[model samples]
Structures are given as C-alpha cells and as structure tokens.
Target: MRPPFPTPTAEDIRLVSAQLGRLARDVIGIPARCVCGAPTVVATAPRLADGTPFPTLYYLTHPAATAAISELEATQVMNEFSQVLAEDEAMQAAYLLAHETYIADRESILLVPELEGISAGGMPVRVKCLHALAGHSLSVGPGINPIGDLALARCSWTPTVCQCLVYDA
Candidate 1:
C-alpha cells in the first residue's frame, strides 16, 4: 500500500518553517512564532523530550487564533506523524491533484496567462496568495536567497503560495 501524504524530512520541516516565517514577516507583515514559542527560525531537527526525531512543522490553527494563544491551539497542531504518509508515490500524486483543485477553486487576478506558459503554472493564484499572506506582489519566486534550493525543490513551481498547502497538508 502507498503512503497517503508527502512526508517532509526533518530538513523539510525546518526549511518550510523558516520560509513560512519569512513569508509571514516580509509578505504577510505578521511575525510568526511556533506554538512552542520559538521565533520560527530553522534549527537542526528537534527531538521529542525522549530523543525521537520530530520532523515537520505543524500549525494547527490560522494565525488569528494562533495570536490569541488559546488552549485549543494544541488541537490544531497536526503531529508530523499524523500529517500524512509519503512512502507512496500516489500520495504525492494526490497532493498535486488536490493542489490543482485548490487552485481551480480559488479566485485570482491574472498578470500572466501561464507561469512558464507551459503548465497551468498557477501564477494567477500565486499573485493573490502572496498579496493576502505577505501583502506583496508575486515577484517573490524561488530565486530569493533565504529561499534556498531545498525550499524551492519542495514548492518550486508555486513558490510563493503552494508551500503551505503542499507541505503542511
């Protein structure tokens, strides 16, 4: 049987957490800190208090609720374990498919017809999401320095918008 979700490695978790933080700051104009009270910077993978490797950053609630720091916060955090299984290629395939649905379901303003003028590229949605998240334009591509190659490899095509959905789902 195939795994049901993409499993980001410890490195993947750390990378995306940092990128999401930067987006929250530079793009969204909101300061992002993990529920654990860390400033959302990437460090070596964190282990359980028992020394088990805990990869993946799981945000359980939307930022507003996170800001309030309500007790319900714990409910929203998806353990990296339960987030999804990535052993199956089908899960990644499903992720891509679900992502396409997410794009089609979203409202957008198109500055370009297609990203590469090849695939559906999602440029329209990218622009909108960046603006909503960072209050900025979609010129934020994978080419940005803080966003290294691994971060790009994770959400390369839909650099600005897709990472949260892809990795965090």
Candidate 2:
C-alpha cells in the first residue's frame, strides 16, 4: 500500500488501462492495489512521455473507488472540507506538509520546473478534489494528509474488501 508496492506489471498496466478506458501513460509504480491485487492508485511520472508537465503524481485508477470519491465530491463536500481546513490550524499545517510531501515525492522521481510548488488537489489551503486527496492518502498512508484521510473516512468505498466489478467506463 506504500513505498514497498511492487512496480507495475504488464497485467497491472492492462488493468489500469481498462480502469481508465485509455492507455496508462508513464506509470512508474503501482502505489496502492485493490484487495484483489488490482491497482487502486498509480504513481505516474511528473511529466508524460510526450514531455508534458503532469503534476498529478498519484492517480486513482480504480473505477469503483473513483466513482465513490466522485460521488462525495458531487455532494458539495469539498466546500465543507475547505471550511474545516480554514478553521483547523493543525489540519492546515498537516495539509501544507502533505503538499510539501507530494512535491518531494514527485521531485524524487524527476524535477519538472513547471510543476514546482504544485501538488495535486487543492492541498494546503483548500479541498478541491477528493479523488486526488484520497489517492494521496491511500498512496502514502494516513496522517500525512488529514483532509485526505477524512475524505477516505467519509466515502462509502473501502480498500479492505475487493470492489472490482465490471468497469464500464
């Protein structure tokens, strides 16, 4: 579920492609896997093979999980999370650290000047996308991203049991 997660195998790439309905590009590692061994979160290159500045380091690839997170976002929960972030000082600090951590992790792979100081989601000061934040929490394990951890807690899906179903999208 963390750094020890194995590198993406051919089947892993295939599953991720199926999950995304497109080719999984520049996936350096499978950061998190489903209970059935499918990739739930993929650690992609900061830049694409075509040399695009891709800032999203950890991407949620599971259809079920993505749907669940999307559902939460649809409920206008990001506003509530953003409000909470504005009120909680410790959470703000942790979230800033999470932004720094995300940058560090991506920089560890390869430094992209265009992506400097940029982390996925609305981290540090806002909660824009639960998918990106929850993906970050799932990738690094909790405590590093408090809002992410909270989003994961509120979502209906869980990584414990297998949620692998017919991914139509």
Candidate 3:
C-alpha cells in the first residue's frame, strides 16, 4: 500500500510556486516526487482556506510531466482514451474503481460536501484531462489509473527520468 502524504516544506512551496508560475493553495502533501526530489504530484485540500471548493485533489506540479501531458492533450489523446473506456468492460471497471479511489483519498483528508463524488480527469465516465489522470497515476502508482498509465506510456516524460530539477535554482 502507498504511504500517507508528506508534509510540504518551505522548499516544496518554492518549487511548486515555480512550477505553477503562481502560489499553490491548500497543498496538503507531496504524494509523488521525481528522481531528483522535485514534486511531480501534490495532494491538495478539497476546500481552500478562503471557503472555495477545490475539487482537484492530486495536482500535477512538475513542469516536465505537465508539459508532456499538455502535449498529449494537444493531440486529442483524451478522445482515444474515452473510446477505449467505452469499448472495454474490464477497463471501464478499473476506471470506475480509479474514480472511487480518488474520491476516497480526498475524503480521507477532508469531506467537502461541495466536492463530493467529483473526481478529477473526467473519471468513471470519460477521459477529460491527461494531466489530472497522469497526476493521479503518479500519486498512486501504476495499475490504479489505466488511462493515466497509458497517457504516461505515450508521453515523452517519465518519473524515472530526472530532467526538470536542474532548473530548480
């Protein structure tokens, strides 16, 4: 089983800020990291401190992974994944399980009524954002998110590679 979330450090906030080009809000933990120690995926709170509902729990914060998923999105890979979800029963089951897992993970942190039952990446029904799916995959690991796994497989970037941390200065 995966470990619990790690507390975000000062360096984490700095790196996340750099990666996002703005301040990251309600970051609960660094669930996924790169080979060079940079955060690849962050688990965020379901509700922001300002009383806004933030539904996305696992956010992709690494510049390289985000860029790779963005490139995949530009090619309309989501449509292909949606088609696969429609055609395969087993895959659909797994995807639904993935959706359930995402919800449970978020609820484990805090149950935000506004964000209830809403998982990111168009889960259980469609493949909307590869970035979110891939972020989920990176946070949880392989076999949990098949669409995310496939997206990572098709992308140029991999967590095994340490490419982005060099620019962390």
Best by lDDT: 3
What lDDT would each prediction earn against the true structure?
0.27, 0.87, 0.88
Model 3, TM vs. native: 0.95
Candidate number with greatest TM-score? 3
Indicate whether candidate 1 or candidate 3 has the larger lDDT.
Answer: 3
Residue-level lDDT of model 3, residues 59-102, one tens digit each, is 99899899988998999878888999999999999999999999
Model 1, global lDDT:
0.27
RMSD of each: 18.2, 1.8, 1.5
Q: List, residue by residue over 35-142, the lDDT tens digit for candidate 1.
A: 443222222112334554432112222333223233222334222212332343543454345334323322121212222121122222121111121111111222
Query: What lDDT score is found at residue 149 in candidate 2?
Result: 91
lDDT score, candidate 2, position 117:
88
Off by over 4 Å in 1: 1-85, 106-169
Better of 1 and 2 by TM-score: 2
lDDT score for residue 123 of model 2: 76
Model 2: worst 10 consecutive residues (lDDT sum): 1-10
